[model samples]
Target: MRVVKAPDVRRSEILAAANQLFQTQGYSRTSVDQIVNKVRIAKGTFYHYFKSKEQILDALADQLVLDMAYHSEQIANHTQLNAIEKIVTIISEQNRLQSEQQNVVDSMHLPDNRQLHERINIKIVLTFGPILATVIEQGNQQGLFDVKDPLSTIQFILAGSLFLFGEGVFNWPPEQAQARIQSMIILIERTFGAQPGSMIIALNQCLNEEKR
Candidate 1:
């Protein structure tokens, strides 16, 4: 008798294989054949789950956003950490995730990856905004932040930063990127009514940790 996997489990296996290939081989170079071979699945089976390689990529992006939101929620709900600390923790988690997936992250900057990159950014904001907004809302209740609309504030923040780092959008030089990042820190601080330099310090620390 042959053991059978559930549809969701099989889909996840396909995605896992695709993710590993995309990481090691780069998205453009990783074909559906490679993914199906990795999973020991037939071509028809692969198509049963995903219409095309691009569909798999989109699913991967959705998975990334969901994972990020899950991690953010964990940090946001840590009872011992204050509102500011929770925000910092969430940022640190983001940096850590990016670092771990650096290769995949770098691929998103390729010229051909523009459309997928935009879709990922939109998914990230849609998924992560509410998680961050919960932290911001808690901060407001604690008098640690003053944002009038937590969800909208978080959404704007994500969109602005995404636009800055977007591959084809700004094409910012190192100096320009640094300047924009600093400005973003200031904007976030003011938006949250946090101390003038607090977010800068926290963000710098997170960046330093990412480098390690």
Candidate 2:
């Protein structure tokens, strides 16, 4: 018997199956047939939800950004933390999640996945920019920041960070990458007129905890 499911439920299953295949076998190696087989769905059913494998990848990217945005928003709205603390906590949580899903990250960096990879970066900028900007705005109002335009400033910062750290785009040596990370911390502090080392100390403390 053909099992029927809601459109959204079926689509989620397709994406979930595709994500697993992509993680284990990589994007180029995983095809439409493999995804359909995993979900036990017909080719027509797959096509009904997604026009092409590329389109599916785009949807997956959007989902990834949405998940990240949800977590960041939760941190942004926390009454206990100030803006700086919110920023640090959000970043720390994101890094921890990414580290746990290293396979997904590695899959996105695979051959023929550049477009998918780039799409995710752009989506992150669009989705996360607004959320982080709200935090910055809160900081600005509290006299903890001096940003002239919260949205634009955060979008610029996010775009730069994504591209710079995006693995396939730039293969920086560990030392160079660390240097850039430190420089970025300083740049953010200066841009927001934060007291020197304030952001650095907080961010490093979070990062150190991750290492332990």
Candidate 3:
């Protein structure tokens, strides 16, 4: 394996540690002092790369986008699943992420949560929206989806999926959470309504959407 430079390697390690800590603990509760203490570095060294706590958080958001993009690639490459199946897989992954995040006491409960949530939404859109679009276009071309606007359909799916995540986090009665996700997915699948013998056209439209 090629060796990474010491500083870049160290920076990534530090950021990874910080991301976990800050995500699990409230941003307000996490401190650079705590980060340095866990990273086993001196406070002076922590300050050398990051001037303020806010800067580190900004970096964390950037990293989140990169991770989401990685996930999108994984969704696109599932061989046994076609476009419609991939959409279900996408939502499944989102559900898994929501479950993981629920354990974290983050700023999502605070007044400033709106700002953070919007930022996260924008990142999610940028990273995964294209993948959703490709699937929608494929479904439409194959007559599997009756949607006239593939773009708008993808947008709705993204928004709806996030809403499911919100309900899981905020709604009471675990069964309600399950019902919400199932209802949304049912809505999406009905909207798409995949049919047999359309795989060829589906693949073509998916490729065309990627070119757009």
Which one is best on lDDT?
A: 2
lDDT of 2 at 186: 87
Supply every candidate's count of residue pairs whose N, Cα or C atoms clash at under 3 angstroms: 0, 0, 0
For each candidate, give its TM-score against the true structure. Answer: 0.89, 0.87, 0.67
Candidate models: Cα lDDT each: 0.81, 0.84, 0.62
Error of 1 at 168 (Å): 2.9
Q: Tens digits of per-residue lDDT for model 3 on 67-170?
A: 55677678867667666667656655654554454423244434555666666766676667777787677666656676667666777777665554542246
RMSD of each: 2.3, 2.6, 8.1
Give the per-residue lDDT of model 2 (tens digit) for 75-128.
999999999999999988887766655556666676677878887888888888
User: What clash pairs does model 1 have?
Assistant: none
- Model 2 ranges with Cα > 4 A deviation: 205-212
TM-score between model 1 and native? 0.89
- Residue 147, model 2: lDDT of 95
> Clashing residue pairs in candidate 2, if any?
none
Candidate 3: list runs displaced more than 4 Å.
1-7, 23-28, 97-105, 141-143, 160-183, 193-212
Q: Give lDDT for model 2.
A: 0.84
Clashes of 2: 0
